[model samples]
Target: MKTKKLLTLFLLISGLSFYFSQEVVIKDDKVLLDGKQILKAEKINVLQYSFYSMKDDEEILMFRQMDNETPKYMDDDYYVLNFLTEKTKVESTDFTKILNFMNSRKAMEKLIKWLLKERVINNDGELNPERVQTFKEKYDENITDRTFR
Candidate 1:
């Protein structure tokens, strides 16, 4: 029957959708990507002094990608910038490294704009200071050290 075929198709589609659903969550020093927790470069702070001492380099900044692709927002409403870090390791990073780091932070800024919009959207919406503060603190922890381009 056509109705039976439609029902089977609907169930298959729903199963596929559920299988692909993802939620972004930061847990401890890592984040869940597509439901898997991976260490975050942005979260891992390399002390500028310590790393430099180990590597004996005078680069102003050092950084690396977190190895996770950024999540795409629902219906392309917004995009999470690939979280980048300039001060990935706090050793003296070179100017080129610094530039790269800056770029990463800039990506974060895009994410921030989207986040702020979300905060304002909730409840028509209220700027919950406590929530805002929490967000600020977390956001700050990730970046706010060196300039991101």
Candidate 2:
């Protein structure tokens, strides 16, 4: 009975994943959803495959052991983003509140990256030979593929 129940649960989760992923296509600077151009990207950036936090005003390239940040006195109008795997296209809106987040699979990919990095790189800010291998395994360009529909 235990094995049967586990199989049922695993199958259910697998089916759900397939159902949720729809096709998103890129055309020019815009992303098409359900064959509709719903979002467009102005800029795209990919760094040395480091985990990112929109909360962190600075982009932390952990492998490089450095941070990429705008000049301290720059205006707040600028925005940055990380994307779902294999895409760099994100969307922004000019609304009443802050517009500082991306609209792609930003949450999923970022979390996965952080978790993978954490595994090889132990706590206390240590980077072992294994950690360097992991970082290279997940490297992406400063502006690879952007525009997730």
Candidate 3:
């Protein structure tokens, strides 16, 4: 009947609206979340392998760099490392390769503690501090020099 068709049409429209409301998109190299620009690079640093985001309203950090020699721009390396390790499974070992290994180890330990406090992973995650330490001991037995040469 006409009533049944109208009801079906209304439901279909509502469902479609809801489904498209949360969609995110990338346009012109900018990341748009819910139709708002969330991430747009303002400057690209090729040597550092980093960039600054255009949006400042978001809770996420905007500045990121990979260079080990230059002074750190952001002071939240501990927090950033924790988030990066949790989200990407990548550690900042390239810095250790260039700088002091001890410094990197200390930073990694702090990152582990931060990850634990944030509860980003379950107890059994392999990146747990204790597990990482044990693994490092077993595999990295020859890395005794902690100071940069």
Candidate 4:
């Protein structure tokens, strides 16, 4: 029984180490991946929004930034436009349908998984752009553009 417990503990530690291996650091006007510089800081932009605090029911302001060139940040739409543009042309009206699909729980979970694995968002859920380019390159090809109509 002791041996089994030790084995289980070892497995858990190993799994956790592998899961947390990806890291992002922003410093000196650059973004870094695993301590290596990856991209210029200018590529990123921060955005602000207002939300109500669940605990106090008070309105609060928050900031979230994305890569300035990202589709979600461009043109004031919520759809994944960058992924769409790479595959096919999209019209303005398509944003609504795309937003609905992407907002589903399943879709949100998958995207969040990718984001976490790629270190696009840090543990605090703030923007971490060190791995943004890598995330884009790896996932962009997997996206499929569809028309709601």
What TM-score does each of the candidates earn?
Answer: 0.26, 0.28, 0.25, 0.31
Instruction: After superposing candidate 2 on the true structure, give the runs of residues whose Cα lies further than 4 Å from its correct spot.
Output: 21-27, 44-149
Model 4: lDDT of residue 44 = 26
* Candidate 1, residue 3: lDDT: 100
Can you write out model 1's per-residue Cα lDDT over 49-137, one digit (the tens) per residue?
Answer: 11111122223212343312334532211111221122122112122212324344443323323334446112211234454444444
lDDT of each: 0.33, 0.36, 0.36, 0.40
User: For model 4, how many clashes?
Assistant: 0
**Best by the lDDT measure:** 4
Residues forming the 10-long window of minimal summed lDDT in candidate 4: 81-90
Candidate 2 vs 3: which has more TM-score: 2
| Model 2 Cα shift for residue 92 (angstroms) | 16
Question: What alpha-carbon RMSD in Å does predicted model 4 have with respect to the real structure?
Answer: 13.6
Total colliding residue pairs, candidate 3: 0
Worst 10 residues of 2 by lDDT: 91-100
> What pairs collide in candidate 4?
none
Candidate 2 accuracy as TM-score: 0.28
TM-score quality measure for candidate 3:
0.25
